[model samples]
Target: MRVRNRKGAPEMMAANTQYVVENPEAFKGKWAEKFGNDHPIHIEVGSGKGAFITGMAERHPDINYIAIDMQLTVLSYALDKVLEMNLSNVQLLHVDGSSLTNYFADGEVALVYLNFSDPWPKTRHEKRRLTYKDFLKTYETILVPHGKVHFKTDNRGLFEYSLASMSQYGMTLQQVWLDLHADTDFAGKNVMTEYEAKFSSKGQVIYRVEAQF
Candidate 1:
């Protein structure tokens, strides 16, 4: 497992701080116990270099944060931030987002964030897309009955694909923005990912939504 040490990311990383974990399996079943609180757990899947999740963790101490990514190199940078910020309420895990059920008990998570996930647009790679129905089913199992998936992306095809998948999984899209930065409340409310900041800075039109299963 090659961990990503993200010294190559642009200056935009300066503002986005987060915690990263190297070997996440060591902390299994300890998230609730370690946080030592019963706050709603909001998890960010595919959390890159710890930007968005970390920022959100810092902002919302009342909410327990768990950021999962398979890439260890980049994840370490995130963990470094947790140590820097001394956040007792945040946790990081290195795992496949597609294999969500392995980590959580049924109805354990309150919210799930999917930001700039791999589009996996090749027709044959549909199964690998994180928002595919199979993955949604996995998420539904771990998420509470009221749990929701908050997704953001610059890929139009994946965004549309996700919309269809969400509906197929018996989810209602609650809030959606075709152009996320159009003075929309979503842009104000969302913690932008590292790739999101780069895409948005380049005037990319990001599509986003909240879906309940």
Candidate 2:
């Protein structure tokens, strides 16, 4: 998502430093301390505009959520939603998903979410996919033992690639949904992201999976 820079967006995010952690690396393994509780930490890697992360934080008060995204413009928009909700269990991190280890210690995270990520479909760009082996390794290092990655996407190719990649990496596939929105039970419990809702309304098939590593 190429988010055009919005005027004063950076300034707005700067003013809300508490919700937007500008120096997340400083917290590192102290994320529990940052949240003022030892609650389980669950993070969304490309948490665009913060819908899923903030919604999860509101729904699950026992879990702390960190929204990680590289785009400042998107982070700014996400910061607004968090503030509007007065959500205390959420924080925004302006960083790339590749830098997960720099901000989290080994076995520090309980769950990781990858929602509507860029597929990087070209064969040559395979490594850029979030479910690529290298990225999975990073998730393994940061997540607790047997920690799970819950992923959702509307692209069939990406879903197939992710399932194959996770299986090749020796991760256990606990659940797989070929058409997530078609299942009434799962759809009701799912926190739909902006992209997911948009695509689903157009009758696109959404795929979801839970893989434990």
Top of the candidates by lDDT: 2
Task: Give the lowest summed-lDDT range of ten residues in model 2.
Answer: 180-189
lDDT of 1 by residue, 1-213 (tens): 244456643332333333344444544555576567779889988887788888898888899999888776677677767768788777777678877776777888899999998898899999998899998988888898968999999999999999999998899999888988895555566788888899989999989899998
lDDT of 2 by residue, 42-127 (tens): 99999999889888888999999999999999988889899899999999999989989999999999999999999998999999
**Model 1 stretches with alpha carbons more than 4 Å out:** 1-30
Stretches of candidate 2 off by over 4 Å are none
Candidate 2 structure lDDT? 0.94
TM-score of each: 0.87, 0.99
Clashes of each: 8, 0
- Give the whole-model CA lDDT for all candidates, comma-separated: 0.80, 0.94
